[model samples]
Target: MKWEHALKDYKLYLKIERGLSNNSITSYGLDVEKLIGYLEDKHISVSPLNISKETIQQYIYELAKTVNVRTQSRMISGLRSFFNYLIFEDYRVDNPLELIESPKIGRKLPDTLSLDDINRLIAAIDLSKAEGERNRAMLETLYSCGLRVSELTNLKISDLFFDEGFIKVTGKGDKQRFVPIVQSTQKYITCYKNEVRNHLSIQKGHEDTLFLNRRGKQLTRAMIFTIIKQLAVKINLDKTISPHTFRHSFATHLLENGADLRTIQLMLGHESITTTEIYVHVDKSHLKSVLQTFHPRK
Candidate 1:
């Protein structure tokens, strides 16, 4: 089949079978598109099923030069999954990227804000403006709930179960989980909803969406990043921070303060304990304490 037709079917498989998010599907599609572009540039006429491992290796070699080690690794993984899907569907007897290996890169720990730094950033918000309250609420929810920006943006009013102290978050692959919400966060969100959001002539489809742009629609992920970046700039913070930074900080802070990795994993909605183990590196002292407290030798 032509590359385009194969990619379209692959995206459908990702959405319907694998249940990947739109953003994830787009990223995976781009990896395949990059391979197609490389083939076109070289005037190589090869069908998806007929593409050779040698050609894929050459494409990867060219790709490595243009991207950082981590990005290259991710793209390689995406391509590998695509070929594996083709193999599963019986469209190909062999996978072109089966033997390809991702580069061995050091694990990059996430950046985090100190508690004092978080306070300073939040304090810098201009409370005089109407959006100030909204921004404050947004940032508070971000840090307090340890939510991804998408989860925060798509959060619906019905998801807030303040009486029970939890908010339902729809995470990657459209999986949903209930994460506990602190009263302080509940207070801020309630203030924003009752004070600011209720006043907007909210667009039809966005009535249940918790955070609305001034245009009375759901907040975009970029807008959330812009808010955090601008706040960082206003405070002259040296670190490059994003909504995910707050998430990292939340997990790190919890671990540093004696919260277990398993609990953090549950709160972060991680599908694997391995994903949560990254926090173990963030606090070596906490690791030492765990050894002292739990080891039979101790």
Candidate 2:
């Protein structure tokens, strides 16, 4: 099969069968595309199924020269998953990546903002521009709901169950969950909707979208990042923060305030409790507080 055809089918499989997000499918496809480009550059003609393991190893070697160790490890992992999918679909008899190894990288800790820092960031918004109202609401929703940037961009007006105090979030793999929205956050979002969004000329297919650009189109993930970066600079915060940092801080603060990890996991749309458990490490002092408050001997 042609490279394009293979990629298309693989993308469909990832979306429909594996239930991966669009961003994840694109990342997996890019890994395969890198291989195709390398073969073309070397004047070697080989299909995905026909490429030798040595070719992949050489590609990794070349990538190692330019990219950092973490990127090399991710590239290797992405390629490994692609080859495994081919084996699963019976397109290949065996997986060549089985013998290959990924480079070792240290586990990275999630960055979190303090409540004061978060307030400072939000306070920095100009609020003079029309989009400022929407940006404030977006950042509030992100931190309050612990939403991934993708989830924030795709959030719908219809998803808000204000009377019920919850918003329905469609997470990775189209998994749906109800996250509780605080009254304060609800007020900000409603203000944005009534004051800002109501006046915009929303585009077709985006009428239901909660956040919109000046063009009235749904906001992109990059736009969300850009907004956060600009806010960080305005506040002169030292931490290299991103939209995901708000999410981590949401979980971290919840844990620090004695909220249950399982509950936090559900709200964050984590598939496993273990993923939420990592927030516990952010504040070890919380453990001492828990023991002192709850222990019968104390």
Candidate 3:
């Protein structure tokens, strides 16, 4: 089969079978596309079904020179998953990446913001501007609910369950979870909706969307990143941060405050408890306190 045809089928399997998000599918597709590009550049005619391990190794060798170890490792993983899909479909006998070893990279802990830092960042928003209240609400929701940026953007007006003190969030792979919402956050969101969002001439499909741009369209992921970056600059924050920083902070802060891993895992909508364990590493002091309080030796 042609590379393009194989790629199209692979993407369909990712969406329908694996239930990956669009961004995830696109990322996986890009890995295969990069291999295709490499073959074309070298004038090597090889289809996905018949591509040899040597060709893939050569591609990896070339790729390692351009990307960092982490990126190279991720690309290899993506390609491996694609080939595994082919095997699952009975299109291939074995994956070309079966013997390929990924680089050994240390687990990089996520960066977290201190409560004071978070407060300063939020305080820096220009409240006089029309988007100020919206920005405040967005940041509060991000931290309070431990939401992914995409979840925040795709949040709908109907998702708010203030009477029950939870907001329904659609996480990765479209998995839905109800996260508890603090009354303060609820108030901010309500104020923004009643004041600013109500005033917006919302576009046709975006009326249900929680956050909208000045044009009344759904806010893009890039826009959320831009908003956080701008706020960091306004506060003169030294560390580089993104919207995910708030999530990391949310998890870390909860762990520090004696919240259990299982509880935090549920709140963050993590599919694996292992994913939530990273926060334990984020706050060693919390662990020390726990040991001091509970250990018989203490």
Which candidate number would show the highest TM-score if scored against the true structure?
3
Please list the residue runs of candidate 1 whose C-alpha ends up more than 4 Å from where it truly belongs after superposition.
296-298
lDDT of each: 0.92, 0.90, 0.94
Tens-digit lDDT string for candidate 1 (233-288)? 99999999999999999999999998888989998989999999998998889989
lDDT of 1: 0.92
Clashes of each: 0, 0, 0
Q: Which regions of candidate 2 deviate over 4 angstroms?
A: 290-298
Evaluation by lDDT, superior candidate among 1 and 3: 3
**lDDT score, candidate 3, position 167:** 96
Query: How far does residue 215 in candidate 2 sit from its true spot (Å)?
Result: 1.3
Q: Where in model 3 is the C-alpha error above 4 Å? A: none
| Tens digit per residue, CA lDDT, model 2, 1-298 | 6777878888898999999988889998998898788889999888878888888888888989989998889888888888787888898887778898898887677999999999999999999999889999999999999999999999999999999999999998889999999999999999999999999999999999999998999999999999999999998899999899999999999988879989999999999998887887777988888889999997
Q: Is candidate 2 or candidate 3 better by lDDT?
A: 3
Which residue pairs show collisions in model 2? none
The Cα error of candidate 3 at residue 208, in Å, is 0.6
Q: TM-score of every model?
A: 0.97, 0.95, 0.98
RMSD values for the candidates in order, in angstroms, are: 1.2, 1.7, 0.9
Model 3 is weakest, by summed lDDT over 10 consecutive residues, at 275-284
